[model samples]
Target: MKNLALFDLDHTLLPIDSDYEWGQFLVRIGAVDPVEFKRSNDAFFAQYQAGTLDPVEYLEFALGTLARFPRPQLDAMHAQFMREVIEPALLPQARKLLQDHLDAGDLVCIITATNRFVTAPIAKALGVEHLIAAVPEEDEHGNLTGKLLGSPTSGPGKVTHTHAWLEQIGTPLDGFGRSHFYSDSHNDIPLLSVVTHPVATNPNAALSAHATSLGWPLLQLFND
Candidate 1:
């Protein structure tokens, strides 16, 4: 009998949203030209939230943002960003909560809409054992080919991916016996519905309403 814990990144584990903050950070660090960066970033984000952008195109465009930097430089930048920016974004309580789960020996996994290449390091940093994230298609030469291996992980896609992972682990959908999921957006409703304990963390309006209606617990992390 195992207890499974599925965590949402961005607003759930961290107090801030990663995608928006990453764009702003790139501008500040001169990684991108401010105006053009913001314009492209905003548009892509809009399309992503609306579920219109294909995973491949989205990942290629995002990776292209790092085109000027070689892998080594980008890796160093990612490390710095995680230490100075991402680390600060985590709430003290949330950190402690995750630690408690780890101490209890539960299987903790991150289920996010973010692409695997971008998030794999962060997931490693967080000490999470597993990650179920959007996977970009790759070419034989190991370049990003701008395609998706599967549907983007969001809405119902979250549940779909999660169930498959569970099956792979030889754990049925309900195998956890006691399971918990934490997320911040209404967009996660499909995934929320499948969990035994669904927590709304700094939810958006729709999720807040749904949580209230379902009598699910709501948690607020940081003020901003």
Candidate 2:
């Protein structure tokens, strides 16, 4: 009986990408060495913005970076980063919009390509009801194994997870007469195409072109 409001996290809800922010935070906190990992991170991010990066390859690269630190350290670093860096990056208007959806009793979800480890806390902080994100696997001893548990939630994979989440909650695709999806990347084309209302928020160049061609509404909350 409830409508769905699915949002892509990176560049959509927050002004910047969550994963990259986490990585940079790790560097600043000494969990990761910036001098050593900067090149890989920069290259990976460049490809990500261009929308040509392979999710699996990027995950492999990022997860491998986690091998340098223990789970306990990673956890502590994540908590610190969430408090200091991630939370501050959220736009005030974006938070208000999320609250408005919650006030209206809509089911809110974050459908992102970022892994669950890096995104779950942020989603919980925002009081999101559901999250569909790539998750890394862990070893029996509770250490990250540098492997993804399933398909990365990007492109077509996003559509699959969004539908699966809806089905799990018994919300038929057509049940929500006026469903909505907000994203900032063309990578979300598959998921955005299915929703009745598609909004492009702080869209990148490629997404802007696609949004223009489709006549979807565009919103830029921050000048930068």
* Highest lDDT model number: 2
Worst 10 residues of 2 by lDDT: 24-33
Give model 2's TM-score versus the native structure. Answer: 0.94
Question: Runs in model 1 with CA error above 4 Å?
Answer: 46-57, 66-69, 138-146
For 38-79, candidate 2 gives per-residue lDDT tens digits of: 777888899988878999999997888776677898888888
For model 1, how does the per-residue alpha-carbon lDDT over 1-224 read when each residue is reduced to its tens digit?
77888999988887776766677778878888899988988888777556465655666676666555655666777787778788776667777778888998889999998877667777787778699998866556455555667787877889999999999989976878788999998878899999999999888777889999999999886553
Tell me each candidate's RMSD, in Å, in order: 2.7, 1.6
Candidate 1 clashing pairs, residues 3+ apart or interchain: none
Where does candidate 2 stray beyond 4 Å?
none
C-alpha positional error of residue 137 in candidate 2 after TM-score superposition, expressed in Å: 0.7
Residue pairs with colliding backbones in model 2 are none
